[model samples]
Target: MNASPKPPALTTSRAAAVWSLIGLVLLTLNLRAAITGISPVLGELRDAFGLSGVGVSVLTTLPVLSLGLFASLAPVLARRLGTEVAIAGALVLITAGILLRVVPYAPALYAGTVLAGAGIAMGNVLTPAVIKRAFPRRVGSLTGVAMMLMAVSGAVAAGLAVPLDHAGGWRLALAVWAVPSLVAALVWGPLAIRGRRAAAEPTSRPDARGGTGRADGSLLRSPLAWCVTAFMGLASLMFYVLMSWLPEIMRDAGHAPATAGMMVSIMMFVGIPLGYLVPVLAARLRDQRVVVAGIGAVMAVGLGGLLVAPSAGWVWAVTLGIGIGSAFPLAYTLLSLRSPGPSVAARLSGMAQTGGYLLAGFGPLAAGVLHSATGGWDVSLGLLLALLVPEIAFGLLAARPTYIRLGPAPLVEAKEIVVPEPARAR
Candidate 1:
């Protein structure tokens, strides 16, 4: 019998490409649904699970902590399993975690959150790196589209979770989210096999910034790198903390629960358009300074309005929505823009995300703890303002046109690459 030719390694079929895109969208949608969805129902979940304030905070903290912990390891996992397998596996974990809430026990509920967070962590870190590998030519536009979908999905889940809970019980509400997670896993599974085939095909590997390698400490030591990291982290810190606490803040200002939740949804909804818009816009601009300044000013205006006039809160909410939506996409764009190429992009993305997320992990908890200690919302909001200054300063630096230089500069023309919001390693 003739020996069978060795199966081609990592060759993606045309079918795999189409399915991978679908899998990407679905996976993006799954990332925030559980946590953002839970925020709207936190009061209910706290009561149902018999959680104290710390316990309630833990519910939110566990996911972020897990995200920070696991995100650091994503590159290694992708190397071992290939991106498709890692992502597909993440979807399975996410599905299991989302369904865990249905068990009617605190341990199960928290355990589910932990597992789900780990899934999200892997997806969050790996997706951008995968995108860097998959779509080197159009990172910005693609990142924009994926992030837009991420926002839309997150908004839908957060907006509807309460209604769903009211209509069918929290167990049903939490469990129902499992449907999408499982579907994503199924969609990605075949594509993953195909993806492995594509990987096996010999293609000239791109340069270091684009190639798969662990980023050096030299890149880590650069000021530009720190700027990217701080910009991403502070932006996320604001984004996540606002998502977690904004509804409650608005409610304290006298808006009804529905209205308060809707405000948060609106903020996220606006983010979808900006997710697409910001990167596209930023890519065309020579310097991102103007974009950064504009977004920072807008955010300041929105926050100022909210602080000054609690009665006209919805207007400020809209303003905040626009500001945040715009700024967030720009932050993601910088990951690719500042990197010399794909490898650096991935490494930078990883560094920025890992560090940024560690800082961001503190946001919700800090806001909640401060609120509890001060017995008011003002102090908490004030702390956010304190943070805004550094966010803007670093954003200005990151927005400048530059890339991290490795050892000796090759005598090659520099090429610009656009990164997307969801594509940010974090």
Candidate 2:
């Protein structure tokens, strides 16, 4: 007749929390390094391998596709192998993929890129779940930390890849990332083993359920979930389009090639601090719709500025960078805030990322087609501006203080439904 007592929250020791944070930072560092590192060295690769434009495009596109395709598999992996083990396994895949590229063949290079991208995809989906489970109370701050690290590492790789390639050839440039991937795996290995051993133990509570709750496939039908997906997809689409063409846009505005490249660097640099600050601010707020709308406005203003005043590009770059940098972490934090528990967070994250990144893969190609068709940057940039309409609409919806309810509730009362312990801490 009485409801079952909810399980006490698992307590992580300060030392253990620090170590876990370290592992997370190290793992986040690898997520975008592989993709960005290759971009700066495409010339070297083309020269060495006699790659055509199509081949070069494939190399650039493979990782984005992998991010979407493999993200769907992360939840299945976490359900089966446990989250910690799945993450560790993903890191190992990344390490192997990075090392494989040093083999000096096109087959090996493409294979390594896909492998690495798949590994990064798993990491991308699971990292938010891990943050939700481990630091539920501090999701905003911690998500900011992780996202900042990811952005910084990516920028560093893009900057260093050319120098590293020059120093010891492209092989060394690609292979050097393997060291950090290996370190993250080693750091996370013990945690995964401990989780597996804990899970193997018999149930401490006789009536404890193994799952957080039944996922009624409601996420597939939920309007809120779609909004989240749209926000993620559109924001990513905008970011990637700019990443691919911002320098060219700058050059077209009468700036020299070197100045255009430097402006791109400035755009990225401006994001670093805003990436850390925005999520922390968003977390402290009750509803993030205002922040979300504000970001959209800033980005719109920046784009408008770019359209009107080509010489004041630095101002537009900084404004756009802050807008986009904040947008990503905002989307990530929404995954945790809008979910009741880590399991739902993982599912939502998987859904958002799979759909989001897939949409993102189209942005650059679409922009290119539009440019070629219209014979100018105006039409392509205008198309990007139009995308902001959907981005703002969905972002506002996703920012509301509401949890995603996927299906009908079980016969058990809400209080009687026990939230499952985190798999990582099991």
Candidate 3:
């Protein structure tokens, strides 16, 4: 008998992988782009829409809240519609939201923000899983790349906000970001189609790396999972809270609008380097507590400066940039580090981000309320300074070398954790 012809599936699989890789980077670039630029133009929005302090706060907080509200749906959509298709849907929402936000009506602005945020929420939860699935052995390095890209995009969006506002107005600045999402959505079109074909084959074995996308609730029992969730939540909360209010804080301290906007841009720019360093360094070390503690120390110094000498705003912005850059990527790495397989990673990623973002969503809102009530930023900054203590405690525990156990048995030691490779084409 003649040997069987080579399986066409292998060639098809490689093509899909390469395309999906491109799609992943494009998607990652948009994750923070929609959220970062708004602060720089908050004053304009307030004047345009007649937004009070509380309303401005609500505008900032709503995207994050939408992230929490819609994050849980990501895994479900991935499981049912296929991951690629689900991601495409997310990009569609983002594009729609960005376009809608630019409309002249105030309600359109609010609606668009929520829509864009929902897309970002799904991206946040699913990006880790896709990274896990595509490059299991290289999660740390790839995750660092993704975060670095995220930082770069965020920095550009913020840095250009004022200039763009000058060129065309806040509407043009906000509207331009939609182009990336629309392009990304179109790129994913082919991938989604391929995924649909693969999913249709009735006898398909569930990809051990979470291609099935089911995040069963088994994580609820693991204390380690909760620790990671809390760490991520608090870290994310600090990041969003500060990102939203820092420019305003600078303005309150008498910086020019352009200068104040640069503060947010500077913070994001600082993240560009740390975004790569943190995860790769965290992955190399057996324990990541030092890394977490070090990031916290940077945050403390930065926040302390902001609290005491709001006059020297630039120095603190760079310092906090160092803190925020490393802080978030390290927390994100935990989602991959703490789990055994891609599917488990996806589940944990989903769970952690949902709780984390919900907690973070409140930070901006609360800060706004306190600022509005007290007529100053002192109380807001003070609360953030106080919160760091618990944040550090949780970061240490979450950074320990332990794996989330999917079964009823106890948690596994660091050595027991396995980093399996993606299945090769036969």
Please name the candidate that would achieve the greatest TM-score relative to the true structure.
Answer: 2
TM-score of each: 0.84, 0.90, 0.86
Compare the candidates by lDDT and give the number of the best one.
3
Give the alpha carbon lDDT tens digit for every residue of 1-426 in model 3. Answer: 989866798887787778878998999999988988787899999999998887886897787889888888887788888888888999999999999998888999999999999999888888888887776666777788888888888778977889999999999999999999999999988878977997798874554333443355578898888888998998998988888799899999988988998898788788898888787777766689999889889999999999899989999999998998888899999888877666677778888889999999888878989999999999999999999988899899989988776667536777733332322234
Please give, for residues 1-426, the per-residue lDDT of candidate 2 as tens digits. 998654443334666677778888888888889889999899999998888999999999999999999999998898789889999999999999999877878899899999999999999999988887766666777878888889999998998998999899998888889998999999999879976886688763211223353345757778888899899999889888888898988888988999888888888888888777877777666678999999999989988888788788888888888888888888987887777667778888899999999999988999988878887789888887888999999999888866666666312222322222221255
Q: TM-score rank, highest first?
A: 2, 3, 1
**Candidate 3 off by > 4 Å:** 1-13, 42-54, 202-214, 247-261, 308-312, 368-379, 416-426
Window of ten residues with lowest summed lDDT in model 2: 410-419
Candidate 1 RMSD computed on C-alpha atoms after optimal superposition onto the true structure: 5.6
lDDT of 1 by residue, 362-402 (tens): 98888988899988788888878788899999999888877
Span of 10 residues, lowest total lDDT, candidate 3: 416-425
Model 1 residue 256 CA deviation (Å) reads 4.9
lDDT of each: 0.78, 0.83, 0.85
Candidate 3: RMSD to truth = 4.0
Q: After superposition, how far is residue 17 of candidate 2 from its true place, in Å?
A: 2.3
In lDDT terms, how accurate is model 3? 0.85
Once superposed on the true structure, which residue ranges of model 1 sit more than 4 Å away at CA? 1-16, 198-203, 207-219, 251-258, 372-375, 405-426
